[model samples]
Target: MKKTQWFDFQNFFYKPSLTSSIKPRPFTAYSFVPFSPLAMLDPTILTIGGIVLGIAIIERILERWGVIDLVDQFSKIMRFILPVTFYGALFYFFATFML
Candidate 1:
């Protein structure tokens, strides 16, 4: 037979002992430990990293084929055209629907 002990009222009021092995730590923003890769394992960061890697690989291929100049020229034209197109679309959308 197993031994049973009665619960004591004094045990309920007792606090953690100072000589205990476990220590309390301060709260931190990140749940992961410091310098851990899990801290930077967010989906958004992973997506951005993948996009940067893809761009770098494409740039290398373009450079190897000597077609980087074409991309540079196209990017220059796009720099001017994209903002105008975006604003024109925004203005038309606002005029037609947003009032």
Candidate 2:
């Protein structure tokens, strides 16, 4: 039966107080815009790639010097290794702690 403040539209239409306009915003601060880094290396991927690349380089040198060709069969094996290692570790951690 009463027009309470919850649905009162008249009170909502308020003018800004003169004191608020004169008050300084002490906590006003500038925001920072982040920039992209030059090189973003994934530790696991890059380490694996580096090891593979090193083996490739060594094979190249050995072939040039006539020693051994190195175990060159598993060059692209990281596709399997990376996923298995990451997911296996994740599953292991989840199973160990969560379940």
Score each candidate by Cα lDDT: 0.62, 0.55
Q: Report the lDDT tens digits of candidate 2 across residue range 1-99.
A: 987657346655674454654666678766473423323243554565676567667657766776543434433554556577667655654454421
Show model 1 residue runs off by greater than 4 Å.
1-36, 71-99
- Please report the candidate that would top TM-score against the real structure: 1
The collision pairs in model 2 are none
**Candidate 1, clashing residue pairs?**
none
User: Cα lDDT for residue 32, model 1?
Assistant: 57
TM-score of 1: 0.37
Q: Provide the lDDT at 50 for model 1.
A: 73
- Report the Cα lDDT for residue 97, model 1: 43
lDDT of 2 at 37: 35
